[model samples]
Target: MAQVKLSAAGERFFGTNVTPRSFEQWIAFLRLELKKTQRKRITASHNLHSIYLRHNNPDMAEFYARADDCFIDGMPVRRLFELFSSNAGFNHRFTLMDNLPQFLMAAQREKWRIYYLGSTEHVAQKSLERIRREYPNLDMHLHHGYIKDNAAVVDNINKHSPDILLLGMGMPLQERWLLENFEQLEFGWVVQAGATLDYFTGEQAKPPRWLSAAGLGWLYRLAHDPRRLARRYLFEPWWLIAPIYRHWRLQRQENGTPRT
Candidate 1:
């Protein structure tokens, strides 16, 4: 079946977004593409408050929107997709906490090697230690994140040539880094996982399981760090949510559904 697509204010998302199926399909596609890959990539949609993000951070939002494939990772987006599909359940639904494990499992099963990039050397070190603790058999060669000079980072990445590269640095910078440098790297797939290392290394906590499952992960995050997140959740919707609501409503009207 064709994926139901929604384009809201110049951004796009699927109608039935399942994390695992999307990821697994990504792997299958990447495996094929990587065989001919002079440069191929994968990126996740950690958060794009859509219009707000674009208006406020046009550079980052544009770069992210341009990725070869962008998976919607959070519950808000997943549910946004689920709105159009009945079964809506696909096996691989994991956050970065879950994504890394899936990747590790894939590496173990297929013997694919990974390179860890981004974050401080200390965070990188601690991340490797923790992953080893969790998945003892997984193989990873680590590199410290985005060397100040792009040329050198590309050179080193080309040399290592791992199967997958996980980037922990935040958006636009990370996306730009990959877009500019991915041509030189040998990795089959590159995933941008914002603050993924921090979460893995116990530096940050994900929303509690209940909150996440209930699609209140944003609420949980807002509760945990209101000082930082509140501004985003509040003022951002004026630019982001408002536009999406208009689009979703337009979608409903186009479908001839009764207005709520």
Candidate 2:
């Protein structure tokens, strides 16, 4: 419920505000925010797929624009920031699966309440069991993403009154849910987490850290689940070409530099 002041130092890339914050810094900021009672804070992260969605979908665009803070969620987006922006500090990319353990540790230490809404019932239960084995003291809740009634789910979330809400219902659906029910939700921090719980449940293979760091995570994922990810990893990036070029041109104009 507290208003945590995240660093406003960031650049706008392809209509998304990219705030680059390290994992440790984010944990610290979450801890600091969890200590107070203020207003609900919505946080989002962007990859190529999300960026493409934001560009093509009005609802997705509204979600990103309304986010209190947005950060780079993929290496490709980070690389684009490095290439297009004047700032050299856009090196941080935070993925939920990569940082969830550390965040859960912080939650346990701080006694912060967490509610995760996504994944199937089986996967959610499996993930809960696994997390309990690792951090038994952590107070966490889970709900399946298949909703029969939106009002009921929102009511359940409000009753829990968790400090952090991890929504992993996938892209536009998750974003749309938040946009529609944001006012009714009472959580302190709402994070747009996608398929992160599935990784924990072994429903999806998480790429190695090295591969992700090297900007080949998408390839690994595509190889693993080509049916689900082929368009996103292989073809969707092509959709960004014109937008990236336009952004580059605008940046050059702003700097009073000659057009390429």
Which candidate achieves the best lDDT against the true structure? Answer: 2
Clashing pairs in 2: 1-38
How far out, in Å, is residue 104 in model 1?
Answer: 1.8
Query: Global lDDT of each model?
Result: 0.61, 0.83
- What TM-score would each prediction reach against the true structure? 0.74, 0.92
Put down candidate 1 lDDT per residue, 1-260, tens digits, no spaces: 33432222112442211233355665565555556735555655544353355545656555655655555566665555556332345322346654566767667666676777787788888877877787787778666674777676677777877777877776556766776665567776787776778766766656766776676777877877799778778777566666567657765776732121
The alpha-carbon lDDT assigned to residue 108 of candidate 1 equals 67
- Counting clashing residue pairs in each candidate, in order, gives 3, 1
lDDT of 2 by residue, 1-260 (tens): 44434554666767666677777667767777677787598778888999899989999999888877777888888887778766565467778888788888889988989999998988999989999999999999899999888898899899999999999999899989898898889999999888999987779989988988888888888899999998898888998999888878887878832122
Candidate 2 has what TM-score?
A: 0.92
Global CA lDDT computed for model 1: 0.61
Worst 10-residue lDDT window for candidate 1 reads 8-17
What TM value does model 1 have?
0.74
